[model samples]
Target: MDLYVADRSFNKLGTVNNRTSLRWVRRYRKTGEFEIHCPATSQNIEKLQRGNVIIKPGDPEAGYISYRNLQEDNDGKELLVVKGQFLTGYLNRRIIWGTEIINGLVEVAMRTLVTKNAISPTNAERIITGLSLGTLMNYTETADYQTSYANLTDELENLSNLSEIGFRVRYDGSTKSMQFETYKGLDRTAGQSVNPRCIFSKDYNNVEKQEFTESDSSFRNVCLVGGIGEGADRKLTTVGSATGLDRFEVFSDQKSLSNVVDSVTLTDAQYQALLQGKGSEVLTQNKKICVFDSSIDKNANRKYKEDYDLGDIVTNINNKWGVRLDTRIEEIEEVYEDGNEKINVVFGDEAPTLIDKIKQLRKG
Candidate 1:
């Protein structure tokens, strides 16, 4: 492998081509690209030895203590000599989101949680984000009027200053409804810090305009929404459905008979994107789920996204009949480890901030 030039010096340049090979240099003779032929066979690229260390700016001047240590010469070694393809295995074998340990624990818990006498919903919520936890949701809404709007505006501003909170919108989209929500932080602990229980995502759309959406539409009105949160309360629950929607259900298809979601389907690209983006990836969508968030494209075939709203973050997205337009957002937290101690802090969901966006939407 040839040495790339960031400057005349051979330092600062990272190694490429061979994943296992390491590189080091003592001095730069001039200010130009340096060809690094193999030390053994001048034609072959030179490789650094495993465990070799390099000295940087400050140190005992020599040896591999820290890169910061300055040296009359440079030093470093390859730690791992992984041979063969860089990729280890297929999706089926992947652990995902550092959740190898997490999955095992979750599986055991779920078996116990799903007991015959358990209080699980008949119609379950499927997370559009396909989130297990640590997901931020952005939602939109309108206030009653007047003083309420002003109050909400102030609250939103105040909430923004709080270290725990996060945001994306400054009053755009949803001529009638407004957008607001929370962000899921970089990791799970950050998610738990929100001290949250429910996402409380609600939207209003025209009653008509229905077509294919979700992985399968025959399921019709039935769609995968969100699962229950940790701190869900029984009292003061806003969902006052005189009709029967007490239990959450899952299904393979929209068929009235098809209930109980057995498995979820996602593309390799989508899956990798999520894994790489740290679960903060775009919402998984089919025609059945309508989304609003950055513009949306089913297959890059329909790439024309209008000044989209929160609905754009959705997939197979439809709105409740009586409501007008609105955009949404999510609540997220901060996560970082402290000297062997883990820390998590929640933010957003400030009732105060909700009042401000309500006021903004009410404005012309």
Candidate 2:
């Protein structure tokens, strides 16, 4: 469905948002030539003004109007909501509600409902049943708690607004890593809990290497509330030193990430993985628009430009496939003709999709 201005994370409208779904009316005509104005695009019917029906032109046989709690039927076409499944406007780290993946989804859904502008408030209690086995081991673990874990005790005292918190952990055999999920309670006096997991346990522990190795990749995400991202400019996320919202936005947008050639270091495989959209949105977006700028990685340029002529080959290939995309960026060459040579390069949006561009350029 088409996204209207009223729908989205920014102005979260009606049942989809935390606030009561705003009431919208439409005109309808009855079989006996009767007309009325009631709600639009909804399953549940509400009584208004003693059920006064105001009919108008272009009325359908049965059109549900949006009123209180409404569901956006993306499957077949839920007559009410006319857009995608209420996705957030700006990207934010996901907060984990419990150690189990499913619980996390619940906390998020509940939190979304509880926020400022949502209309329909469904009972988040069902998330209790969907709890993962990991949640049993660590009932305390939740997404919010995990984010504040390093020295969570410090936060407990100051959080008069917090009601509770949850925690849990996960253990990785290969990396010998133990992961945790934490959740923070709502309302004042919000206590926190933690969850931990032992994925390296004896039962069914032996498996293949991984998707993120020297030739693969991996990532970590956190969801925070209780004013976590409220005031900060950046989303308080980390991806190598440059923390705050910038990193969050950068990783989320493939375009911004491309400009950051000096931030986190990258390997051929890892970079390629991002290009292939195998890693987190940050890494994927980063790879989608970025390439090895010769000036920064001189040593890499040395090997590729001299020993294997890798740089030259890439240049030749890109030139062949591209329609005057940026001229090949050569580093070792002297600076006689304009230190920063203007290579005619085509970026995303203005050119082709990332996948198509990479596919076209990789032929050589």
Candidate 3:
């Protein structure tokens, strides 16, 4: 695999070898990352910048992971450890502006939101640049909202969740523009016909490591959604659920209700959307089904681009272990060293975030 460095002007600076390792991670509905380790002298250190582009050729799955953070070890010889975040890191530099979007299509809403990101929220004097949105997918629902100071990633995800769709932010290594899309949206092509069961095997030669865990640590069924502020005006919408009530009671407090127009000024539809999104988020958390990490070369020759990827549903049945799992690909981590590649694939129910864990703990 070859790594290239380019300046902000998209001009090729140079390339370097003497590499140690290259690692890239892909996450569902969240930002992913990549890292490159190389031993370089002090003279070549100037080429690595915050916003500069780092391209890794030969892999379609980890198309373009950009540099986010950098570390260095220079005792006798300079060893540069370049850490990077996925394309979604672009949202870190963009913030949502307050705009009342009523009865707006999700595509339009996304486009509208991107337009607001034209100016940098932090640097009022300078404009935010280098954003090129792809074809926004059409969804069924008409999104409505009264926005506030929200991060661009959160804004996109919330809108996506409300619309009952998945969102992914990607950087086009070829186009040199930021890209956004709904999971399984038109931007993505249909997956291949390769059988998932045959794609991942547990044979001694194919499998290196495998593990599974089931936890109720982040389970939530009943969601008592409370809108902004206090008092009777601060209405509470409850998503009644009876599952797992006898084993343990799970509850969630949705502090941000989009439909409540009293204090947050969100319309009823908006509130319902938030309520629905939160409800789905909670209901899916009842059980952490199956977490599988397998290293296999079964489908290494098959097309992995649009075929097997994060968010694709796959069925796995291991009769010996009495494990039958039909789960989505949550995270795909790849490690390359010494001219050999080992891809670690994680399949499970929706992975919870730190906030999700805290919310579950608070209920207890």
**Model 3 misplaced regions, further than 4 Å:** 58-77, 99-111, 118-127, 139-147, 158-166, 173-175, 185-199, 203-206, 228-234, 243-289, 298-303, 350-364
Model number with the top TM-score: 3
lDDT of each: 0.21, 0.23, 0.58
Candidate 1, after superposition: displacement of residue 139 in Å? 18
The clash count for each model shown is: 81, 84, 4
Q: What's the TM-score of every candidate structure?
A: 0.16, 0.16, 0.74
Error of 3 at 321 (Å): 1.9
Error of 1 at 329 (Å): 5.1
264-324: candidate 2 lDDT, tens digit per residue: 5554434333332312222322232323222222222223213222112122112222322
**Consecutive 10-residue window with the lowest summed lDDT within model 1:** 83-92
RMSD of each: 24.1, 25.3, 5.2
Find the 10 residues in a row with the least total lDDT in model 2: 26-35
Q: Can you write out model 1's per-residue Cα lDDT over 1-364, one digit (the tens) per residue? A: 2222111111333333322222221111000111111222211223232212222222111111111111222344322221110000011111111111111122222221221111222333311111121223432221111111122223222222322233221111123111222332232121234322112112322111232212233112222322122334211112111235533222211111111213544443333322322111111111133222221222232221222121122222333433222212221111112212111111112122354335433421
Report lDDT (Cα) of residue 223, candidate 1. Answer: 28
> Scored by Cα lDDT, where does model 1 land?
0.21
Candidate 2's error at 235, in angstroms? 22
